[model samples]
Target: MTTAVDTRQVRDLAVAALAWVSAHRGDFALGADALTADGPVDLTWKPLGELAQTCVSVRRCTPPSDPLHACASDLLDFAWQQTGRGELFLRLQRTEPFATYPLEVYSVFAGAGLRHTGYEVAAGAVARSRGWRLTEHEPTRRLGLLNAERRSGIHRPERFAQALGRTWLGGLPEPWTFERTSGYALTHVVFHLTDWGRTAQDVPAELAAYLTDWLPPWLDTCLDAGMWDLACELLIVAASLPQPIDAATLQDPWRRIARVQHASGALPLMASDPARTHEADPEPSFVHGYHSTLMLAFAAALTQGVPV
Candidate 1:
């Protein structure tokens, strides 16, 4: 029987991947600078394709042989400072040699400050520490036809723990994996400003969209519904609105992607079609956070037009 891996080992493996990618920031054979203002890394923003490329590159470069060796080691040391001895690895074996990570993921990470100080420092740390173990809850059966269609080969998402010594303000996790965490924090800043009676112009365009399209419906469905964790997703989306939010009430912009679950357990937003929703996924929370953050960021960009 194949042995299931432990969480710490998985963490280490993940750290290794981030190190490889970080050290190889300019090298796609491991890590290539993922974000560029004008275009995709490979000039094609396809994530599936990028994964294929990344897998091939990583497989080809071993720890000792790769120039990123020292960088990777350094990252691990940093990681150990936070979480201790985590193991990480790709969910899939490297096979296709030509695939590269899509620029969007890289762009998203970079735009969100994945590598800079106070950025997702946990990219390496998480990959180094975290705890987990397997348990048998139910029988499993392979999805042959469905799996074939999704191209969803089994590659586990890179997960990890906070490194030990590094302390961020307000006890926030570094390199937050889900965009929702960061988005919500940013959103609260905007909300308090808006609720406290701040001017719309004071806000960023990145957050503007949410003021209309995202806010009301989110409040309608998420708050009214009992699903609280998903609420985090909604808060994050709020962060992406642009400056000078358009005059809009909370109810106007909901695409009504799912049924609203207010006052009870039913969520209308949840029932809506995924494609029609702002972001496509099992839950709209993540998509909501993503779009909100993006819109707010765009608003920040508009400031560039002004004479500094």
Candidate 2:
């Protein structure tokens, strides 16, 4: 017989994780050189965008009565204000008309109803340009861009199915061939297809079936390896499946993550030893813990029956 997962403990984990993010919201600020031509958009902009994206997921998954919903809303407000209520996005789009990062980042806020008409108009114009249309991206990234376009009210000429077909996951590669890189890629393919689990039914039937069959073992391996960050993501993917895996099956995995999570709610990139539960670090690096912590909260929120 399977033991039931502790619902209260899962909710507490989500609460603590969001608390950590709120305390470190200042760290998500862009550097002074962020707006420059040679800006480190990947470093500065990507983190902030991911923050907003994850906040959106949290907010969407939790009910208004839930503290997590309020926490996520606050974070989204902070992220939008950081972009100067979208003024910075308009400027970045103007300066780099062909750049896709600005639009992609802006799309997260826009989808949450924190829009800037000026940025929208500018992005729309750029979307119609030949240069923008011809810009190249890796298949997974291309899927994200197309989804961003659709979110921001821009035209999406490419069919989602066509985009999916171009991805490694869409091809339904051999399960045995799964590795670190492919693992991340396939998770994203599912995320982009389902809008971070808001629409789990959006996942193709075949893909959902494949994940249902293989995800449990993969999640087990990740937890066993103490790959906390990737394991959190896989947890989210598990919750996103059409027929989500039994909560009883996840009791052990959740307990494993809880044991490694710092008192402040940060998670290291990986545990030092999978065989032993290590003490939480007194001071964890923000760079190492941020993504994993956010993913943990997101997964926890999804576990509360947020995803349809």
Candidate 3:
């Protein structure tokens, strides 16, 4: 007999998580080598993109009166500035014209009404080439490129549905086959399909039905394993469906997550992890913690209703 999740608790969790992210914004800054092809993109660009993307969801969902709205807006502004007002993206585009990452990162800002005409013109020219259209990517990667193109207003010949069909989730694979990597892949599949939950209706009926059937057990598995990041992502998937799972069904996971969340709103990568080192080893903490925290905020925002 589960109870409904407290709306106030959800809001409070989001507030605290955003507070943590805000305090650690500096950790997301790019290193001097960030522009080089061999730079540690996972640490620098990836986290910043995730931060900006989650902030976009927060601002989109929360009302101006909500504290989250202001906090997320500030963070989004900071993230944009970190990219040197989109100049970094332009530079990356020039150096790695065929790379999909910069375009994908830029698309998040683009969707939020941030634009860099110079980047777009250059990206557009490259994207229109036969090589760009013909390049092969993994199913999930292909979906990402397609979504980035859609968000950035870059026309591509590929259809989203066609690309989606090639994905693991699109195949509607056996539910028992779910694993760590597949879990992330499927969540991303949903993320792309629904535009990070902004357009839940975009989820095809069959895929939504598949998620509705399997997501509860998957959520339980992640939480039971103390995989906070994956659990939060599953929650986002749950909320992104056309008809979201019941709040009651989510009570236990929410309670477990709340218990582990620090007073400052940061969460560990997994259960009973090391004591946080804000000074000595902030990178590990920031890289692992930010995604889960941002996911929590995004899930909460979706539950609060983003007005479509």
Candidate 4:
């Protein structure tokens, strides 16, 4: 029942989303001293990381001549200037349970920002090294660590490959399910294995086989549940597989997502449903739509192959 993705529609949605972020860049900014409090720091990290991911993906899909290219570049520069200090690490160290799962989460996106922006942060490097040292004690975070390294372009292939070899993906808790956190983790593993779709040939045969068999059902389950963010991540996984998945299978989800995007370019966390509420609070927080919007941008860039 699925149809081919309308490439024009995808591009249009991406353009709108980028324009929204550009216009609201001020709201998304992480002030130099913004990490002074726990609530503020956590809020700042989420949107900043999301925007950085979008910027990187947008850059991949377009040429320098594209209008979005300058916006993405400028935004990354501003983000780097804001958080490149040791503040992120300082905040992490003071956080509860010293080596918590949140540290791994922050590392994954922060590293992605660095890798995509090509901005060098000596402080970030120190923080990542510190985080890596901490993660050695948490086996549950192995996949997270691998994702951070790969996305940040700081990976050790032999070590990472060995880690992947030892992992029993099927044995992991609800390994391939559509639950948000764990599901994202699973997709991140596939992404790292494939080098974010840049080197599909590098995907391990076992993992690729597993995804080949399971991804379709998983994608269906996520869409059925209206888990758009996770669905987008799954789309990236499907696209990165060594043998391409049929584009038609992904078209429906893409169109559904585009239809739900607000006029301001922000894609909602979920599609329209009378039971769901979609308005921002009195003080509009950028975090509300950050993930879905970023995911849409990433998906569009990946699908539209960058101009040569």
TM-score of each: 0.22, 0.94, 0.93, 0.73
Give the per-residue lDDT of model 2 (tens digit) for 1-308: 12377777888888888899899998898877778878988778988998999999998877798778998999999898889999999888878888889989999998898899999999999898888887888899999999899889999577899989999889988888887788888889888888888888899899999888888888888877778889999989988877787777788888888888899988887777667644454446888889999899999888865422
User: Please, what are the lDDT tens digits per residue for candidate 4 over residues 34-67?
Assistant: 5444456456666776676567656755788987
lDDT: worst 10-residue window of model 4: 275-284
Candidate 3: TM-score?
0.93
TM-score of the candidate numbered 4?
0.73
Clashes of 2: 0
TM-score of 1: 0.22
Q: Judged by lDDT against the true structure, how good is candidate 1?
A: 0.28
Tens-place lDDT per residue, model 3, 83-147, is 99999988998788898899999999999999999999999999999989888899999998889
Among residues 3 or more apart in sequence or in different chains, the pairs in candidate 3 whose N, CA or C atoms overlap within 3 Å are none
* Poorly placed runs, candidate 2 (over 4 Å): 1-3, 274-283
Instruction: List candidate 4 stretches off by more than 4 Å.
Output: 1-3, 32-34, 37-41, 84-141, 146-158, 165-178, 271-285, 306-308
Q: Candidate 1: which stretches are off by over 4 Å?
A: 1-214, 243-308
Residue-wise C-alpha lDDT for candidate 1, range 1-308, written one tens digit per residue: 01121223222333333433343333222222222333343432332223232322222223455433344344333332221111111111122111222211222223212223221232223222333112111110011111111122212242111111121211333433324334344343443223211233544353354344545454445444333334423432332234322223322222221122121111222334433334333423422322222221122122211111
**How many steric overlaps are in each model, in order?**
73, 0, 0, 0
lDDT of 3 at 290: 82
